[model samples]
Target: MKKLSVSILYAILSVAPIAGAQGDIAAQVVPQVLSRSPEEIRPWRAPVFADQSAALGYNESAFSIPKGMEKQVQFWIDVYTKYTTEQGVIHDAENVETVYEIVDLKGLKTEREKQKKVDEVKKIIAARLSTPEEGERLRFQLGQKDRMQDAIFYSGRYLEDMEKIFRDSKVPVELTRLAFVESSFNIMARSKVGASGIWQIMPYTARPYKMISPVVDKRNHPLEATKLAAKLLRQNYSMLESWPLAVTGYNHGPTGVLKMTKSYETRELGELIQNVRSRKSFGFASRNFYASFLAALEVEKNANKYYGSVVWSKPLPAQDLKLPVSVKYKEIVSWFDGDDSKAQVYNPHLTHKARKGHPIPAQTVISVPKDKYNVALISLARKDRTVAMEDKKGR
Candidate 1:
């Protein structure tokens, strides 16, 4: 009995110690039940307690915040300052109220400054563009009574067409009368210095617009040249953006108009006219364009009272055509000039009675009686296409 008791005691001692060791190991593996709160468990990276609690939930220890990053951390607080109701929530932080007030004041100031800039831009654009007074002055120029009877009589033909051109361009209808003072509506009108056509297009200026070709200076063709003239006027209007400058430029070229613009400084059309210093440069003709337009208006207002409407009513319409010019001048003259007459209606600049020494230039689009000669002239034009190319130097 004693031996059995001794064996049992040995087993109990050995197994009991082993069991105790296992219990000790289990106690070490179990997580510790700490008394510290979630916020207290981790150092605050953010000032907010919620952020610290999130850190604690993740079982983190001391937070590894970046050095010298206090401002960065406070920035989030500043952004969400309204949400923070706790007293002393952002001690030593930016004064959010002051910052927001300053920002609002700055926005107001910026808007005022922006409005000022917008007003300035509007003033600049207004000065550059058209104005009512300018329109009135131009009207006066068209309504002038100088060269009264003859001016109106001669201009009657082209004035009708110019009216249509100006109307299409939205330029005042009265300004069309300047064609009388410029070219007398005669397509063949040439200045002593060689400016030609109704618009008085100078050779140098007309060359660039392709108004003058080797065989033909289309500046003499009223419809063709007027189309080019309108294009040039539109371009000038874009730059100076004034009808006055545009009209002056039509007479004096763009460079001349630009000089006037610079001399005046301000782009006001009235100022430009008022400050006119030269009679030769931006002088008499340019100055008189407005006067001429005014005169034209007066004539138009009382067309029948001054000059009968018959001549004005019968003014030729502007026609646009890609004329097939192939017939030699001799052939064209034979077809158009009845009874072997040498007179050519189209190019008045051409030497009369064209002979072998002065061979008739081909492809010449003679603006004859529109309906009467169109078919016959067209058939003759197809005969000498090569001759048109041969005499390219005369023009």
Candidate 2:
């Protein structure tokens, strides 16, 4: 039997990992597909999970963790994250482009040419992987070790909220796994293009999901953003009808995905990825979005397999407080020991004024720490009394 190199396999699919927060090429054979006739060797049908757990199982059995598809996912995450962290706001992150270039460069038949190309690539990169150790660290960052351990930690802390939100939106709970692809559940993760929060929602997309900002961007609020993610994803699924396409649309816009799905007359995600990437409007980011998700899902599903044991983050304990009217930031913070940043953290959906300790619009829903529940309520009541007193005196 003839063996196919990992790079060759990735080339056919254009399977670079998702852009920032999502990631590229590494190896693990898809035996069933690999053994097939030349015509049969493309990404198999995208799995439609019965539930969140089953979808995760597909990620594991189908794509092994460390050496599996997740390794590629980790690759992109490390590459892109490294760029953004080091360069500080990479407007056009070149991680995806670099992967494509690497594939093409490797195709150069001569070792001397490839060496020359490697030097060229190295001089351009901020994170120097010149040493084997540096390359290993990049891979190891998300590869089934300490970094994935962090993923497992955040997963424990936030998965319940994600599942509940998805359930409420009437979408498949498994969709929660996309966070592993988007931001690695790092709530603070921000892409250069302003894809914010754990789900990496762009500002424009958030508006359609009833998320607005300059006050509060719910994207940074884990619980609220997860809910919005479910709604946005549900809308995508409703439009696309295919789970795979729906998931792909989450990374790329649904309208474009819908157009390709119709024009191509097939819903095979693998084919669509290959075809769409060739278009002038599209690129590797969208092409490999699903694969990136698959990689994260695979690693997340088989956490114990890669690491000896996982320590999960504790579930968030908080209460939703709906302000009866527009409330001053002072009033909100008064309830929580006058810490302004706490308001920002809990009420991430606030506008700039409210987020920065100014008055927020009435009827805003904010998350408050459960431990401070009574104090918050009392503070609000006190504000109401003070307002009434002032009105009485004026009368």
Candidate 3:
């Protein structure tokens, strides 16, 4: 099959969400879900990997937390999963990019009241135990702009392709949402810790996946990166033999999460995260990654409540084209309409030099307008000699 690269990140923005009283929106899930501690929350189980495979035990009934740990799991899921909306905070599970600020800056009014509300918000975040400093920085907020809406709109653009890749790899298609938790579908997202792209892939994961590094991180290419991620996720699932652990392993790494499970000899993922919360390696992001996925999944399943209503972006009509050889921009423009910037837009992964007369790696595949395939193919077939040898080296 000839895979041609095509840009598919286009989106159609809808009208701003309906205006409503901040209290009205915040009242939906904030107080009940946020204020409740692990002890107060009930243990509940949800199906996993049900979209495709079940042999891994995900096909079985919902799996709830072990006794005495429901609240702990629920706490992380709610806070970590919740994003700020214009009305109130909501879970990514709701499928809407809504955020709610606290109407009351709980600890700002008076010293006593401030500390009391600060403690309450702290408890919701569990930062009281983990990073109490966040609570101090966190004021009670009621309404805020839903910044994630644009990202969510873009998510509709690539999610289908991602799921197709997952299906082909025999990994659970539902893992597509992991991108939402990772980088909110931001194609160019980068982390201070060095993770990048839609999957927020770190340097270590990037190397094994064969992505171009530093200057040309293929991790930014959603479709290619997702394929690599699915394979990694599938391998993790095989090693850990637990869906939750495998999902968390994407963030914490399979070796450590597997070690965590072995240390306690319990396959219960919630138990593992809860137990290892204070470990040097098992920091907040790692501890909460899997549960946060669950939280997002839950809200997504119930998009009406969280998002109110969502508009999806149509998938881009595109085809992939592989470079026959590493050629410079002048050569590519001969094939494109003599517009270098237009050619660059079609292939975002190309380094600046590649667009400015440097050789585009022969192994590189670029997405082009669907109609441009034949033209690109003919142009490449008729031109340069094969850089097949260099392609393997680059890969």
Candidate 4:
């Protein structure tokens, strides 16, 4: 297969100097020809590969990757399965398929040293880009490799529950695999930007779903978060009318994606991603979001092929108990012989205030071990009656 030329490579170099650069230049460049019509922007041609055996599997599923996006999805599959944290790939940010090289940084001691090596590679790529006859190369440095293997291992803990949530909500069950791309099924994961849980939902986005609160941010709870994520995804699909755009909206705001669709005059996600001029809001991450998701789905669907025999974490066994009245966290822990750790493990959504003896709001449904549900219910009932009696006496 012939490599696609980086026609706009020089546009990227015209920006800022490469000194101590940490971000991709391709992402920074705003092409001068943003006025070009959608038809003027060449459509993506599926890359021809020598081995048909390595081609992506096709299914009539709702989440199937578009033909134009196969190369991008395949690139992400390599990032997830072929690469590890110790390595990084230098490639075109716009055209994910055009790879400059993959540099191994195992021996690099510090982040500064690793970045310096990456910058050196970028300089070479720049030179190559300047001289188009040298070869096909462009700009971008992606180092964060997917922990898909770990994600697959942990997904067993919540995949069944997530499927039920989406199914009950009438959303596509396969969208549950999005956890792999969002947070790698790391239940405790929280982003610097305040997106939390396996879904990586922002506080603002989760607010409408009632997932965020002072007493509990349900976004940290895998099952609860999955329900909200399902609703949010459905909302996105309703607005965009495309699974690819809806998934992209999960990363980039739906409004932004809608704006891009209008600006580019195309609803085809492949066309929007391929032709949309670079900007601050919809950049590399947004463009590749769906591709990464499709990659995750493929890798997870064929886990045994990518990762051999795997031991998946067992789903937690628990029963949901709704609190009759506001109760303290420690009191709930007392029901299980003061096993704070066990209590926390089951109800991971409790806030700091709840932990510090502040009352958990009434009607809050908490999970407790199935075996201990009866005893916990008894204790909760007794506590509720006592509170009621105190209120009656005060009245």
Best by lDDT: 4
lDDT (Cα, 0-100) at 65 in candidate 2 = 28
lDDT of 4: 0.67
Candidate achieving higher TM-score, 1 or 2: 2
Residues 131-182, candidate 4, lDDT per residue (tens digit)? 6633233444443333556566557667876776766676776688888777
Q: Which candidate, 2 or 4, would have the higher TM-score against the true structure? A: 4
lDDT of 2 by residue, 171-213 (tens): 6665688886676565555555667777888888888765765
Candidate 3: residue 79 Cα off by (Å): 5.8
Q: With candidate 2 superimposed using the best TM-score fit, by how many Å does residue 317's alpha carbon deviate from the native?
A: 3.4
Q: Of the candidates shown, which would achieve the greatest TM-score relative to the real structure?
A: 4
lDDT by candidate, in order shown: 0.41, 0.54, 0.54, 0.67
Per-residue accuracy of model 1 over 150-235 as CA lDDT, tens digit each:
33444544555665665566544444555654544544455546666666667887777755544466776666666666666667
Off by over 4 Å in 1: 1-162, 165-173, 276-281, 305-310, 313-325, 338-343, 346-364, 368-395
Measured against the true structure, the TM-scores of the candidates, in listed sequence, are 0.49, 0.64, 0.64, 0.76
lDDT of 1 at 124: 46
Rank by lDDT (best first): 4, 3, 2, 1
Clashes of each: 20, 11, 30, 0
